[model samples]
Target: MASKVTPISGFQEWLPRERIAEQYVLDTIREVFELHGFASVSTRAVEPVERLSDQGEDADKEIYAVSRLAGGDDEARLGLHFDLTVPFARYVLENSGKLTFPFRRYQIQPAWRGERPQRGRYREFIQADVDIIDAAELPGHYEAELLLVIADVFGRLPVGAYQVHVNNRKICEGFYRAIGIEDVIGTLRIVDKLDKIGEDGVASLLLAAGCSQEQADRCLALARIRTSDTSFVQQVRALGVSHPVLEEGLTHLASVMETAAEHAPGVAVADLRIARGLDYYTGTVYETMLERDPGYGSVCSGGRYDALASDGKRTYPGVGISIGVSRLLGLLIGEEGLTASRETPAAVLVAVNDEETRSDSIRIAAALRSRGVPTLVAPKAAKFGKQIQFADRRGIPYVWFPGAGERGGDAVKDIRSGDQVDADAASWTPPAADLHATLVTPGSSD
Candidate 1:
């Protein structure tokens, strides 16, 4: 009997060409992260279940537990991390003595969750994250810097017209308390569902949660406040709610929006409703969405955490953002037909004239490879026409002939254009554009 092979629902696997395209995106992300002076760090995939579960509201349900099939009862409980941030918090604690203050690091890794799969939501996904952590206290300017960092990243990618919706937790907490609502987190969780359930639904839920009709209406009013500039400060003030925390949140959010407007125009919006569900985020939360579809959940998000990582004596407060690499690629490459120019990276395939003279073709390929040109030798001593067909099938643009030039030296043919010219293996170079596989999207001018 033969065993059946099946793919799990949420684990994504791409074809060869698609994988090459994915690498291009990853390389670009890594280069930009380095340009900003963020050091790379990788964390273990699993953490103690207790630590993972403490992330906040509704987080424990998503954790995928890990246990050995034959392990004894003494094994410590573990679970695959739902996101990179949790493990990163633990990493800081274990290595705090050796790390410098205001540490900056970037991590790119896969995370797992047990949630039901849906569009742009996956059980297994890749996340590219950057965080800045400092001992005891962190500066507020880091929040503004993170928004610019995300803008820089998206500006380089093909993701067109996205906005980072910004909000401060203090604004919500202070405003809720001013209006006599006792449950700040509970109200935030419901308001966060505004996109899923419209204004009426949220109002009903708020009322059901024991908020007075006026309080529910007030909460809805605050969530609806959104602006592209620092003007949101006045908008909150117009609502006639006042608290020291609310005043502090207004000032903080105003500074962030002002910085974004001056440095990264049109990239950040002050959206008061963006109360991230995680309990760890202390202030300044963000959620990014494409301009074309406001409902397509956030592709990048994070926030300021004042006490996520702490030792008995010290605390590490930080602000960070994560790009949902898998979700972004799912929309770009899977549905939008983004791909690479070739299935293989080889730019030139050397042809063998005969079985006895195949050594000549191998030597030519070796010379090309030495010069950093991606080259491959013919698999068989097939006819020249058949060899050309093989190169074409694999999207290899050029085919090299060992000794087919007019002067009996050597030649290379651009199979796409049918242009054959004399060339030398030791000195020849492919055009810069042809040297490596290039990412492409359907209907793109490039």
Candidate 2:
């Protein structure tokens, strides 16, 4: 019988090349993060439950509290963080004095949530996060730039086509309040399900949340309009513009659109519709989708949260975006045929010439490594044919053979193209382009 087994669902472990493909997604995001001048920082994976309580943004429902099997009476609890943004906010508050203002940083780490997992959702998943924090107030340009960074990352990635849908919290909440809807978060929670549930479902949801028939109609009416540019203001203004909250919403939408056109143009648009699920976002909010596959849920999303973090003395305003790396990797590699390599980690393999010259094989592998090529020596002194096959199976591009008689120093075989030639380990190269991995981007799918 199999060892008494229990498998926790929604958790996954990666093998060699699968992990390489995973790293490709993460590493791409890191490069994009640094290119935009954001510094790098990582927070402890667990934080005191108090720091991540219901006081912040509303959705901490899936927090997993830690426990030790060996028990003690002094009780303490910590939750594995749900998202990078909250941990980052606490970090900024704790070290505010030592750090510079308007902190820009990127975090790449795993988070835990006990939610029922599905195709792209997980009990544990890594998020690539970048946020900008200011001591007092953050400018509108920061809002525009944040979306631009997100688009830049998505644009460069090897995933399918996508667009970032942006909205201002003030705009959405104000519009709701102006229309006399009291529970805006409740309304947003319903609206957030619109893409998943369709128009009628959201209408029913709003009605269930005690919104008036006219108010629900207006809300669904607003959610119906999706545009590539920011002209959403004029159309929404045409809908009905008597309320101050609606008026303010239009103005803020105009501001974001104007700035996006002037600076990070065309990356965002005012979807009078984009009522992101969270309540913490007080200003601009974002949701990105693959144009062809919007129902797969947002590939990246975030918003501006004003006054969410405070140093007991002053408030720290923040705005940023996060991309689901594993989520995208699953789609790209699994569905889109966007794979880095199916091979194990080695880049090159050296042939072993029996027991006598295993040392020679080691020397050749070392020489290849010194030339900036990752190399591995064959496990045993075996026949040249078997050694070559080993290199072939592992996706190692070049195989090296030590010269036996007068065949020269080393022989290099290009496993991919089946071209074999005499090559000196120190002087010869397998082409510069092949030496470095090519990053697959959205352009590749076309």
Candidate 3:
């Protein structure tokens, strides 16, 4: 007897209809990325353990180490990459000589992490990432420009009423130092938990991490600043903090909000509390939330990395954003009942009258397929009623009869409407909408 098979936790597996929905989301993202002139790139799945060791204090625990069952001691240690950014940074350093300055690229691939699974978080998940890197200083304008690309992508997708919350790390770092907090990274790690622990919980953690009562109160005050326009700059200044880095951060984020207001109004928010847990983000960071469900966590997030990668001679500065494709679909398809119109791609099923006449059905299917229709030949020479029932069972809208027309020609019946009309296999076409399977969201019109 075979050992019983069970699902490995955190590994997402979708059925055929759900898979089609996932592909639709991916295709929309790829189209928007290319529309913005970002080239595509793919990096290896496994990297040397030494290279993956420095992501952050808590990253190592989430890494899934890879090893051969019968390997010898001389073999190199390797691990599956937890995210695309590290592998991408290594790729840039390895190919610096061949790549052009201000290189723009997009990557859609699976990333592995050995973490406990939650509603939207998974150990094996797909991420769609777009990044812009330069050999030297990357322009500040690109920071704001990435928001437009993200807005365009979400606009084309079915994800409704989303906002991309933007923040600058310099603002937090500068303000922390000006208030006598020495461990900026530790403080950031704590403040980043504001959403999970609440303001009081975060303040307790901050105090435990060596913050005075006034300092902890000031930190929470900074995190509470949220706005939709450039007014956030004045809000930070009103808190009575003074540091060159804080001033610079306010200027940079103000510029970003100003650009967003003009090009993609009401889509970007200046939320100072968005401290992405990753240590690599050096400047601006983002966290996207759905208006209907802010507690679902960020469905898309990334940020600027002035020192993403560096060789002994040069450094690559860049900024990027990644859409959590798996997470978004979990809410849309798994919970919200988003799905495709049909289980299969076939739009028209060619019915076989009998075994001898099956050749005629095959010919009709071939002709229809040659003309761009998704046609399928009946598997068996069943009765006409049975064949029509087969098509209906699979959600195939039309059933083609090889020679049931008024003359000795082909005819197709819309199974839903019971309307049969003469159609020439050589030239007949289904309606544009029926040519391909379409996404169907609950409560949305067909």
Give the least accurate 10-residue stretch of model 2, judged by summed lDDT: 437-446
- Write down the lDDT that model 3 would get: 0.92
- Residue range 58-121, candidate 1, lDDT tens digits: 8899999999999989999999999998899899999998899799999999999999998888
lDDT per residue (tens digit) for residues 1-446 in model 3: 89999878887788877887888899999999999999999999999887787877688888889999999899999999988999999999999999998999999999998888989999999999999999889999999999999999999988899999999999999999999999999999999999899999999999899999999999999999999988888888999999999998999999999999999999999999999988889899999999999999999999999876898789999999999998999999989989888888999999998999888988899999998899999899988899999998878999999889999888899998999999999889999999988998999754
Model 3: CA > 4 A from native:
none
Candidate 2, residue 325: lDDT: 74
lDDT tens digits, residues 92-140, model 2? 9889989998789899998888789888788888889899999888876
lDDT value, residue 189 of candidate 1: 90
Q: Clash pairs of candidate 3?
A: none
Better of 1 and 2 by TM-score: 1
For residue 104, model 3's alpha carbon misses the true position, in angstroms, by 1.1
TM-score of 1: 0.97
Give the CA lDDT, 0 to 100, for residue 440 in model 3: 89
